[model samples]
Target: MLRHFLTLLVLPGLVVNSSSSRSSSEEEKEHDDGSREKESNGHHSNGHGVPWGYKDQTAWTFNFTDCSGKSQSPIDINTRRAIYDPTLPPISLEGYDLTDDSALTLWNNGHTLELILPNTMRIVTGFDHEFLAAQLHFHWGTPEVPGSEHTIDNVHFPAEIHVVHYNSKYANISEAASQSDGLVVLGGFIQIGLHENENYEKILAVITDVSIEESNTEIPGFNVRHLLPNKLDRFYRYNGSLTTPPCYQTVNWTIFNDTITVSRKQLKALENTLKAGQEEHLNKNFRAPQLLYGRHVLASFMASSTIKNPGLGRMGERNQSTEQSEGLSRGDILAIAFGVLFGVSLLCFLLYTYQQHRKYTSITKDPRQNVIYKPAMKAEA
Candidate 1:
C-alpha cells in the first residue's frame, strides 16, 4: 500500500527520506517564530525564509502545499502537452557577451539570472523582443535527492533550474508575470550522473561564498549565457503560473525535454549549502503539490497544435513533421498497455483471495454439519 501511494504521489528521481532529523516540535517553533518576525517586520514570509520587501517583494515559501490558489503551481512538465509557438521569440547567442563583472554582480547580489535575453535575439524570423537578463536561483534538497518544485509526468529530476527573464519591455518581474508576454522562464532539469559539467562547476565554485543564510550576495562578472544548452530546438511549452507564491499565473514556461548532466560532486556542493543547522541534519526544502485547477494543458508537436491559428507558415510545416515522428514511436503506448495489464491482474488477484477467505470463514463456523451417504444402497435395491 505504501509503495502504491508513493508511486502515485512522488516523482521518480526523488529520494525519499524515512526520518528527518529535526523534531516536529522544534520545526513548529521555528515556523511560529518566523511568522511572528514577518508580521512584526511588516513583511510577509513566503515560507522559504525569504523576507518580504526583499528583491521586489518576492517571498519564498519552502513547502509546496502552502502555495495553493496562487497562479503558479509546480507543474509536471512531462505530463504537459508540447505545442509549437512560432511566436516564440528566437533565442540566439550572437552579440551577447558574458563578463567576469556580470558574474561578480550576480554573486554579490545573491541574485541569479533566470533568463538572459538580449535585444539582438529574435523570437521569430523577423519579430524581436528585448529582454533583460535576470538571476537564477535553485530550490533543492540535501545529499540524498534533488530539490525541484515542479515535477515532470509526476516524476522529479535530480534538480530543476529556473532561468527567469523579464521583458525589459515590461516594468518589473511581478508586472511582467502579469502579462502574457511579460515573463519567459526556461526550465532545465538536471540528473545525477558520472558526467562532468564544466559550466556547472564554474557556478558551484562561487556558490559557497554567497550561500550565507538569508543573506543575498551578488557574484560580480557572472554572465547568464554560459548556462544554456547548445540545442534549444525541442522543448515543452505551456502557459502556466509560477511555481511559487503569490503564484502569478502569467508565466510562459518552456521546459526542455533533454536533461543536463551535473556531477555528483557538484550536486553535493549545492546540498552542502542548503544543509540545516547541525551538520547531521538534511535540508528538506521542498514544497508540497498544489491543486490542479480546471485548466487544460495543451501540447504541440505531439498530436495537434494548441496555439490557435499560429501566424507563421513554417511553424505549421514543422508541426506536421514532429507529429509524424512522435506517431512512429510506439514505446510510450506499449508501456501504458503493460502498466494497465499489471494493475488489472493485481486487482483480480486481491478479489479472488478475499472471496476464498470469506468462504473458509463460513465453513469454519458450521463445522459440525455432516451428512450420511444412503444413495448407493437405494440404487442397489
Candidate 2:
C-alpha cells in the first residue's frame, strides 16, 4: 500500500515539495512557448530579456522570484538517499523515430544551443499525462570543470541534455508553463567516449552556423531517440524547476540513471562551439546544486544496483543506407560471452567422454575382434 502511494509521488508534474504554489500573477508570467522559434536578431540587455548569467546565478533571485524557491533544480542526487519506487515505469517516448528531424530548427539561444523539437515527439508515458516535446538544450563544462546540471553521487559528467515538455492537457507549452502540474523535463547525462557519436551529427555538424546568439540553422534529423540514454527504465525523478533563469518551479524532473556518450572531439565542439551574446565562449553553462529543501528524489529502478547504461553512442557511425538497429547492451554482451564460453566447455567435455567410451568399448570387446584380425594377418604373411 505504501509502494502504491509512493508511486504517485514519483509521477511527473506531481510534487509536494513546493512550500507555497506560485500566485496568479506569477503563474501567468510569460515565457517561451516550448517549441516556438526565437527571433534571430533578438539580443538580451533589453527590457524583454534577463541579463542574468552563470557567473551570478544567485542574482537571478532578484529578478525571478522562483529561482529562490525551495524546489529549485539541478540538485546533486544522492542515489543512496533516493526512494526506490518499484512501481515507477519506463519513460515512454513517442514519435522520436523521425525519418527527418533535419528540417527542424537548431538555435543558439545565447546561453545554450536549443533544438526545437516537434510536438509529434511526445512522451507517451511515465508522466501523469502526455507531455509534448518543447525544446532540448545542452549544458556543458570546459576541460577544467564538469558541467552536468544534475550530478549523480556528486560526480559531474562532461555535459547534459534537457528535453523540455509540457502537458498535453494545455493548448500549448506556454499555457502549460503556468500550471504546477504542467512541465516535465527529461535529463540525460553526457559522457566522453572513444568514438564520435553520429547521432549528434545532425546538430553538431551545424554548430558553426549558429555560433552566435539568437542564430539558428535547419538541422537534418537522425533518430532523436539516440540522443538519450539507452536505458529509459532507470531514472531519478524529482520535483524541480528550470535550471536557467526565471527558473520555473513547474517542472517535474526525470534524470536518467544512464548516460549517453560522445567522442572527445564532439564534446569539445559542444563546449567551445557557441558564443555568449558578448561573443565570449560559452562553456560550463550548468547551474550549481540547489538546496533540496525537503524534496525527496525517487528512483524508477533499484538504487542499490548499478545501472549499465552504456548508451547507443558507442555503436559508432553507420551508413545512411543501413538500417538502424538496437545495439547490444553491456549485459547482453556479457551474457553472450558467457554462453559462448559455456558452449565451448560443454563441447569439449562431450568429445572427451565420447572418446573415452570408444576406447573402453574397444578394450572390452577385444577378444572376439582380435581372434579374427590374427587370422587375416597370418594369411598376408
Clashing pairs in 2: 101-221, 102-219, 102-220, 102-221
User: How many clashes (backbone N, Cα, C below 3 Å) per candidate?
Assistant: 58, 4
RMSD of each: 16.0, 16.0
After superposing candidate 2, which stretches have Cα over 4 Å from the reference? 1-49, 305-381
Model 1 regions lying over 4 Å from their true place:
1-67, 78-90, 93-96, 101-103, 106-128, 216-223, 275-283, 289-291, 294-381
Q: Number of the top candidate by lDDT?
A: 2
Q: How far does residue 338 in candidate 2 sit from its true spot (Å)?
A: 36
Can you write out model 1's per-residue Cα lDDT over 1-381, one digit (the tens) per residue?
233222212221111111122100000001133432111001124333434322232234433223344335456553323344445444544323445444232221111211222233323221245554333555556565656656766777767776555566654333343355665666677778788787777667766664543333344433455555556655665555555433435556666666777888888776666323233322334454454453333333333323333543432333554445433235666888999999999999999999999999899888465655565555565
Across residues 1-381, which tens digit of lDDT does each residue of candidate 2 receive?
233222211222211123355311111112143221121111122213546678877788887677788888889997655655666667899889877623676767667777766777898988668887766788899988989988887899899988877788876555555577777788899998988899987789889999987677776656789999888997887777767655657667888988999999999898888998766998888889999876767766653332322221221232332222223445667999999999999999999999999999989988775564444345565
Worst 10 residues of 1 by lDDT: 22-31
User: What TM-score, over all chains together, does every model reach?
Assistant: 0.56, 0.69
